[model samples]
Target: MTAVGVQPSAVGRGDVVLRADGLSKRFGGLLAVQNVSFSQYDGEILAVIGPNGAGKTTLLNLLSGVYRPSSGRLHLLGRDVTQEPMEARCHAGLGRAFQIVRPFPEMTVHENVTVGALFGTRGTTLGQARERAYDLLERTGLAAHADKEAHELTLLQDKRLEVARALATQPRVLLLDEVMAGLRPGEAQEAVGLVRSVRDSGVSVLFIEHIMPVVRDLADRVVVMDQGQVLAEGTYHEVTANPQVVAAYLGTEEGLHA
Candidate 1:
């Protein structure tokens, strides 16, 4: 599909990098997520889209270890991490970038990334972490701003920094929560390119996005959610064509872009 005049690259499926089975989360009497399940293959860019309060954020939190599932199991790289803490999941090859870009304001761009490199994975020496940070800065196109304080960058740059820091963890899978939230059209296009580059580097990507066009252009497969459960799973065309999805999220065929 063409999006903003850009075509997505061909995706090659590989081993399952992440999987969720019968996942559920309970906040007292509320079932924020219920029996949600999906698999992300190596090198795939997967998008989860739904209306507000559809449990997308809750699902993200479960995957990233911010909240343990009240029921069900999570597997990362073939290991069970259902009960693992956030840091443990990071060590097990799960990286996450939030919708809100929160960089260490007092730290330089390079130093901020360096912090991720140092703590994300085990046995990384400070020297090695510094090297990795600089390399990530270049890969994320922040090399020119390496010495600048994190607070001095623009919104797009902050988004890039969020992604760069996540990549520094050397995760086999990356979870992004609405990374395009406040970006203008041009900046959103740039963010899309960055996400594509990240997938090209061999990391499986799973993201929750509300922008239909971005979901169409970036995702290899689309998973639709509503009322805390997966409503459908297929290509962008297939899911958008589903009548249930149309009523619950898209509103109508033409509303896909609205």
Candidate 2:
């Protein structure tokens, strides 16, 4: 396998990994994401947060090439991948874990992740890909269940498997959609630790999460959305405390307290 060069700065503690400029998407008459713009620096965990229908998922879809943008551009490590197909983007080092975990029920956990390694990056032998897949499974703590059928796994394990599959692709940038939604509080903390470990391993993460506490604890920066537009962007405390953000999404004091 040919190694993709990592810049010294990017290998350092901080560097810009992904950037979006005026990215937008529409579905029929509905505009799901409108001129959204943001940048995720290398080694940082950037969180996208909003109430339901705020277009967080849609924005991710555009970034991941699941949906083409109606306007604007997407740059991954300074490359314009706005119109690139999903496979092409994956080859370019973009990886995504879906909000809805979709594992091949009949396949073993190891087989499922091995598929990602086979197709992702440039190319490699089946043996090499399987080796990489096993390493990813171990990193994501799914090694114990590698031989089990995907359908036999619990919800939390399924989530970990989704992440493990994405990691098998050797992505430089990963988009995680609600990996913590159904996890218990303790489980959520463990997932956060895994995310931190992924960043420590040189992969940058942009995640959409609804759980406020997890977002507050994990994100280096937070971007809030409302009605498909950015309502606020800042640190977790700054964005949550913004009056406009509260009014637009969190509602009144009673609403927030509710």
Q: Largest TM-score belongs to which candidate? A: 1
User: Candidate 2 on 20-77: residue-level lDDT in tens?
Assistant: 8788888899988998877777788899988899999999889899899999988887
Q: Candidate 1 regions off by >4 Å?
A: 1-13
Query: Which numbered prediction scores highest in lDDT against the true structure?
Result: 1
Model 2 accuracy (lDDT, Cα): 0.86
Model 1, 152-243: lDDT tens per residue? 99999999999999999999899999999999989999999999999999888999998899999999998889999999988999889888
| Angstrom error at residue 6, model 1 | 33
- The stretch of ten residues in a row with the least summed lDDT in candidate 1 is 1-10
Q: Which stretches of candidate 2 lie over 4 Å from their true place?
A: 1-13, 252-258
lDDT of residue 219 for candidate 2: 94
